[model samples]
Target: MKPSGSLLKIISEDLMPVTEIDIRALAEIYAEENVYLSVYLPVSRENEHVNRVFVNSRVGAIKKVLPADLRPEFEKTFDMAEELLFEPAVSGERGRIIFASAPDSFLHVYRLAVEPEKSLVLDTSPFLLPLARLRADYEDYGMLLVDSREARFVCIRSDIAEEKKHLSTDLMKKHKKGGWSQMRFNHLRKEAIKSFFSEVVENVQGTCDELQTRGLVIAGPGEAKQELMDLLSQDVRQSVLGVIDVAMDISRDELVEESDSVLHENELSTSKKKADELKNAILKGGLAVAGVEDVRNALEQARVNVLLIVKGSSVPGWICERCQNLQANTRPPEQCDRCGGPTSSVNIVEELYELAQRTGAEVEFIEQRDFLDSDDAVGALLRY
Candidate 1:
């Protein structure tokens, strides 16, 4: 993950928010001999006791099933997990995740603002489905709060909102003079307002681009918000999900709360719109492919632009040991079809996720399983 920058301050330097880079790095990690212990638990103050009990029971059960030689190492990782979770610094976090490997003496802890589903997985690689979902749900976005005289730009990422820039420009005040002077003053006041708005728009675009925000939300009291919207370039305007009417003096917490609704609505609408597009493409046999095998092929050829998969979907599959090619299969195969290399068992959905990341394809997790009507529970909108 990228290092924390000056734009925001995290709860702690050690406990940073998960990023796409972190996910990609985790996906690449694998243990050839010793397994990695991945644990997710609700760490909210009220759940402390329950967290301890759950971890103890889960660890004991897994230890019983493990080979005698591996039990000691497994216990070591479990101990590390417990220590990290119970640290006083972890109390306020709504959730916590620990990835530990005893043999490698590796331990990584991440704090979550939102509670994740409680899960423990012992595997060759870290369990990343939860992290993937969290990243998708809380992608970075920009919030612009503006009035005729001032503008504030805030970047919201992983549930943390930080004000990045504040801009203000002076405007000519209303005068009580007679016709000629009054008209001239009105003309100058309008010019000043336009100039201020133009400056605000420039900064809005620059800040959003610098932050690489995924979406934008504009808010203001009256015509200022609409006026700023009108001044934005088409590219920046397209990134704006919606606008809100609010006073300039609104508190940061209130602004975030208001923008939350807009962000949530945008997510739902965007997902539905993409689903419809996928459906149409499939009906016409145009640029979409559904089912695991076809989607895998499209991804392998780098033809996929957007990959759609039902949330929590998985299938028994194989990954070629030599080629790393993913194939979904119910039955085991001795060798890979393409490279004639030995294959290893894997979860097809997870492998598909990694493949999509490797190919720079955007992944959309469909919450409604029946949206695509495919048994494989996966589809792709292709570039070809």
Candidate 2:
């Protein structure tokens, strides 16, 4: 199986490639003790020494706060992280994330093409908000470049565009003799083109299914692109995000650049559409809820169909240790209201994001927009 996005598995003992499955597994892990240590380190050939010093300082500070019995285990996990982060083989990666729990005998390291915010957190579970956001930003898209004679299918994930398949069809040349023979040739050419388009549509369906692409972009010169678009099945047509009029022989770099622009525009459009849906639902008091508390409740009940949040927004809150009840508050009570248990400070936005993922609700991070900025920074569309 191909690794998702530009993520590469670091070559080390117990280090595995980061994929959606890995992220979900990490997110599911929870422990009563705060043994999980998650570290995001940004490294490059030019700043290796600087990153090492930063890691050392962070590790020293973390160790000072740990209990005497857990200090040794924490140090061991940090040592493993340092070895993986500074390895010369992975110097090409822009950053790395390591999740280690020595007490649980678990470790995972991932090399990232994009630089992540440097952070070190010791918690009951892995800090996965950054990874989740990165995964969201790098969702896969399909590109189809077609002309009357040929078609090329490319699967784009992150910044990489890889050609998945190519197809070509032969048609008879136009007859010079303007007579019955020419009409017959014309008829045969039209039939051949129709057959070829049908084949292309079938192949597109197969390729998209195999690659699990989230969206599709059609590009080519002249009318062939539109012809193919008209022939797409209803299911496939809905996935069409954009169309580009470009030369059939466009360079790979240009194709990727153009496709990236289309995908980004589609994302913004989709975000706005969802925001409008949420606003309309709220005005009608249908099945939508806004604000951190109500959205969290919807997520917990698995009634959320889509969860919308403003990018880079956070709400200070607390999660009950015993019942996992989340409450958004500026000042957390000493004990949980639902169950008289101790509470720990948590970022409610991050908690809601993870909860939405776990419950199979689509998460949409809306960029700074007037619609979302005017009211509560978080909202959800319900299933009921």
Candidate 3:
């Protein structure tokens, strides 16, 4: 029997791979942790991307497969593993397996991701092509923030969301006394919002043109966003999905959490609101509507792109004489796989197990400890 999704995972025991790989051709490979595992799967989406996607910033070495001459050794590596391969709906010259890991089944979910850049530059997109075409590929959508004194735009992967302004910052840089200082800082904030949006128009619009999508978000603090809406070309504004009301101190990190907190209060960044919705859905057993039955159906159809289940909820299906919670089955014929208990006395009832059984899914269980604490993990993405 295939192991539960909980059994397969990948964790970076070497957290400094970025710096190490960038500085050295290949950093010393570390032994895999007991909790970590990795896989390769077919690629989807774009066939062209940047070469530097996964090279640690310091090592500067892009991920490259064994040269053509090394095919003999490469095939040997695959033969050594207990493996299975599924082609699914791949249409490109290459395919990719998504490598994800969870700590103890759920606490921290690790996605195969390209590191974010500090500049409003979408440098990572160009790097995904070769990487995905090779074995050590890591590509996934992400967000970017573009700012100018007059506008601000938040590009989520490709779709563009913007906020622009003509707020007068020209008035405040003079006095550090009294209300004047407070007034000046507010003006700087307002001007920054405007400039951010202008850059968004130049960046996100140029990237997603070929992709058919809409409802991109535009957000940030102050009246600049309202001003940006007024300035968008009719063609651009029509694609906007939401404008939130939130603000944050400038951030150095480009992850969604840092930028999102500021925009959560605005009418532009809806990350928080959508996160709440997904959480509500998951809690309502929406994720396990048919439990294993639904999963079985999905597996048969090969429609399961991602399958998630809460961890530690796994239990055998034996009727325990002491507690009548679960009906017992196979009273004594089989051996227990996990606890070595008599198979007849225990019953299996993990929500994920049933889900996995039904779906033939490559599973990833989030241990209670690894559960994503934020909505970003499950939030419905808004695109424009």
Candidate 4:
């Protein structure tokens, strides 16, 4: 089975390749008390040099946190993580490693669909917001194609459509009878149409519920598609994105090709709406904040409900291991602001993201820069 999104999963010690259960277990342990180390390494097919480059750069960063006694143990775990790349089935465009040594030493590694900007973070809590964001962006869609005698149901994910069910009425091609027999035949055909539509609705409902389909598309040659749409429940109808006039007999490749532009436009419109919400909130003040420091402060208090980060932005900062305080100070003091304990420097931008996850705030990467000024690259909508 495939892992759902980027949820952390757990794997049995002896398992050669990672499993979906392992990823789920990993998400369950995101709040673990141990020092959580999240490392995102690029392993894309296009970049064969990523492994060697990341290993050299990241090994030094990981060793910086380890005391003399724990270096050997960390090295062993790092080596184990590297071994996963040699397994063809386990390799992916990106790789993630989560490690800790508090209550018990543990390390888990898994593949990622998209390459996250390479990062190595050690924090009080596991970094899960990025994974959540990634999952939210890659959506699942349901499509139903129907005509008078035949219907097909499919689920689309990552632009790939998989046929779930197909139904045919198998109505008589020719009939010879008197006037009374002709009436009866017409009634039977009507009943068959109704039955086919009812079954189609049932199958679509089941698929949507199971897969959490983000949106649904309906297509067919004639009036049956509209008639079928009218039969759907209000909740299901609201999910209907578009009804295209296409022949039900079309190939799956043709179906996807025709639907691609519509789906892409819908996604862009939804993203723009979200960006507008963030922009309006920022203009109104108090309820929202923009830029690095203000949003960081709001996140520290767990006041943020949504974090809007400009795509591909990173800033350096510090996190307090003792008090969990985060700061963007260029020269962090020896002691933490929240508690008098040693603080460590880190990528402040990434730490803010991890904090948003820990606090249950939604995160969105805004690609449209025109929504705000350049200084307002990172912003948040607040609860208070």
Best TM-score goes to which candidate?
1
lDDT of 4 at 79: 62
Off by over 4 Å in 1: 1-15, 90-92, 170-184, 300-302, 316-346, 369-375
**Which residue pairs come into collision in candidate 1?**
none
Ranking by lDDT: 2, 1, 4, 3
Worst 10 residues of 4 by lDDT: 14-23
- Candidate 2 lDDT (Cα, 0 to 1): 0.78
RMSD of each: 4.7, 5.0, 17.3, 5.7
lDDT of each residue in 1-384, candidate 4, tens digit only: 112344333432321212122323443343212256556555555544765676667778768866787667556655645555433423322444444433234555555434545665545445554554455454568888889888888876544567888888776656665534777888988887888788888888888888777788889897998899988999999998888999867887788767766676777776677788877876776588887888988887889998887765666777666666777757667888788876776666666776776577877776646755444568888899
* Predicted candidate 1, C-alpha RMSD: 4.7
Ranking the candidates on TM-score from highest down gives 1, 2, 4, 3
TM-score of 1: 0.84
| lDDT tens digits, residue span 138-196, model 2 | 67889999998999999876555679889998776644566557667778888899899
The residue ranges of model 4 lying beyond 4 angstroms of the native Cα positions read 1-9, 12-70, 90-104, 111-130, 157-165, 174-191, 219-224, 243-263, 371-374
Winner on TM-score (1 vs 4): 1
Quantify all predictions' global Cα lDDT against the true fold. 0.77, 0.78, 0.33, 0.65
Instruction: For candidate 4, list the clashing residue pairs, or say none.
Output: 8-23, 8-26, 8-27, 9-22, 9-23, 9-24, 9-26, 10-22
